[model samples]
Target: MNQDNRYVICMKWGSKYPAEYVNRLYNMVKRHLTLDFQMVCLTDDTTGINPDIKCYPIPELNLPANLPERGWKKLTTFKPELYDLKGTALFLDIDIVIVDNIDCFFTYNAKHEDSVVIIRDWKKPWRMVGNSSVYRFKIGQNTYPKLLTYFEQNFEKIRQEVRHEQAFLSNYLREHHHLEYWDSSWCVSFKYHCLQKIPLAYFIPPKKPSGAKIIVFHGEINPPDAITGGGGKWYRHVLPSEWIKAAWQ
Candidate 1:
């Protein structure tokens, strides 16, 4: 591995998000990151993805047939041999919008190279859960057999304890590694930080978050919804946000 190689990887296994999300992410990273890096996407379908971005098949988690899928596929990113990718990998969810310089994500903890860095969950701060929407870790490092083997053996027990993949991942890394977080302001949630309160939501268009490098659309309201003002719910009305149109592209 080249000492200078940095990687930004995103997952797009299902049809819930289109290829445009991957392309736009590449463009956003190209604009913001000063460092040289390879843009990679792991997807089930790569028909329309930009040729500049490398495409790899999403590794199989191989869960039981009766098991429910709650973002379990994302765990495969920790595969021991991830298509020859090594060194630091920053994983971004496809729906997230980059609005500022993101070079800090790779450089935040310069001394602690072994630490697993992630975004602190916006909703569950007290429990210290990490939202996997944005996280940086060394490829094929701590989590391969340590995280995967445990999950495979104790999937039943793990499922009973945590609802989703992020919770499972956060809990494991916290126990084993130096689980760090990006600055709270750098990875803001669009719905939490930008959307106005109920009645006011109708009057005001969604506001662009200040000091946010990546605006995360966690549960609802993705980039398209923000661009066209489709907040995806009846009560939450988002008037066409022009900044989203400009920024998401």
Candidate 2:
């Protein structure tokens, strides 16, 4: 592995998100990330993806038919020989929008190469839950073999015991004392950290929290909805955000 190689990885399978999201993400990453790196997208369809971004077929999980797909699909990235990629990898969810410079995500705690660094789940501060929207790990390291093996060997048991991929990953890293969190200000949730308090949310559009590098659209509020002002549920209301559009671009 080249000592300078850095990778930003994302996965897309089902048709929930379009290829434009991946293309936009590649552009955003290119704009914000100062390092010399490659953007890898694991997807079933690459028809409209930007040619600059490397696209690969989703790794095989070999999950049982009865198991639900939801978050479990992300585990495919843990394949020991993942797309022949090695070195540092930062995984970003398709819905996240990059804001400020993301150089810190790669440089911070560079010495701690063995720990799996992930954003802390905003809602579950007390529990050892990690929001996998953005996480950093070395390819073929730690969980690749350890947690992957655990899931494979205990396929039936995991199907019953774990609720989702993040849950299993969080607990596995917690047990191994390998779970590390990025600074709270680096990666924040759009709903929890940026949205205005309840009633104010209706009149006020979301703003980027100070020092936040990435805004994760967890649960609801996709980038398209935020741009078009269409992501409103009965309880939560989101006003159109031009700033979000600029950042997402």
Candidate 3:
């Protein structure tokens, strides 16, 4: 496997996000990443996806039917030898907008052999957690087999214990002392960091934070909603911005 090559991976399953989400994400990534890389979309429907994007069926987790589907499928990314994807892999959620150069995400900790790198969850203040909107690891490396095996064995107990997949993975890494965080400024939350005060949000459309490579849309304010001011709630608001239109294009 060539170390120079970067593999960017993302998944799309249900109708919550359309094929356009994947297409927009690919364009944003191309505009931002200045590296030799291939973008892979693990998806169930590829009807409207671009021809250039490498599409593969979403890897099955084989979890019980009772288990919630929210973020459980992401666990498949940890499976050893996932689709034989090689080199450093950076996982980006389809909802994210690339705002700056992301060349460093692949090379930041190249010297460290087996560490899980992720964004510090902006919502969690008391305990350390990884947001997982953007994260990096070597494909097929199996950096934390014990954690993966444990989750598989104790699927029910782990699900009952943690709030979600990100929390469970965070606890696993934190316990093992192998979890590291990208600079807080690099991957920022749109709801919290971008638009803090409700009144101010009405006047000033969200701006790209300094040194931010990716702007994450964790909750209700997705890129489309942000652009059209269709944000769900009163507190969760955004002014229309031409920049978002260009970035999403």
| Per-residue C-alpha lDDT of model 1 across residues 80-134, encoded as one tens digit per residue | 6787887789999989998899999988864466577889988879899989899
Q: Pick the candidate with the highest lDDT.
A: 1
Q: Which candidate do you rate higher for TM-score, 1 or 3?
A: 1
Report the C-alpha lDDT of model 3 over 1-249, residue by residue, as the tens digit: 565568899999889999898898898888888887899999989989998899999876646776656697777777767776767889999999887888889879644576779988777556788888888876776665666677778887887788788888888877774778898888887777777477887787777677777888876678888788767578867877666677787
User: 141 in model 2: Cα distance from truth in Å?
Assistant: 5.2
Better of 1 and 2 by lDDT: 1
Poorest lDDT segment (10 consecutive residues) of candidate 2: 140-149
lDDT of 1: 0.84
* CA shift of 111, model 3, Å: 6.5
**TM-scores, in order shown?**
0.94, 0.93, 0.93
Candidates sorted by TM-score, descending order?
A: 1, 2, 3
Report the poorest 10 consecutive residues by lDDT, candidate 1.
Answer: 140-149
Better of 1 and 2 by TM-score: 1
Ten-residue region with minimum lDDT total, candidate 3:
61-70
lDDT of each: 0.84, 0.82, 0.80
Candidate 2 per-residue lDDT over residues 3-96, each given as its tens digit:
3579999988889899988988988999999899999999999989999999999877766675556677777776767866877889999889
Instruction: State, as a TM-score between 0 and 1, how close model 2 is to the true structure.
Output: 0.93
The best candidate by TM-score is 1
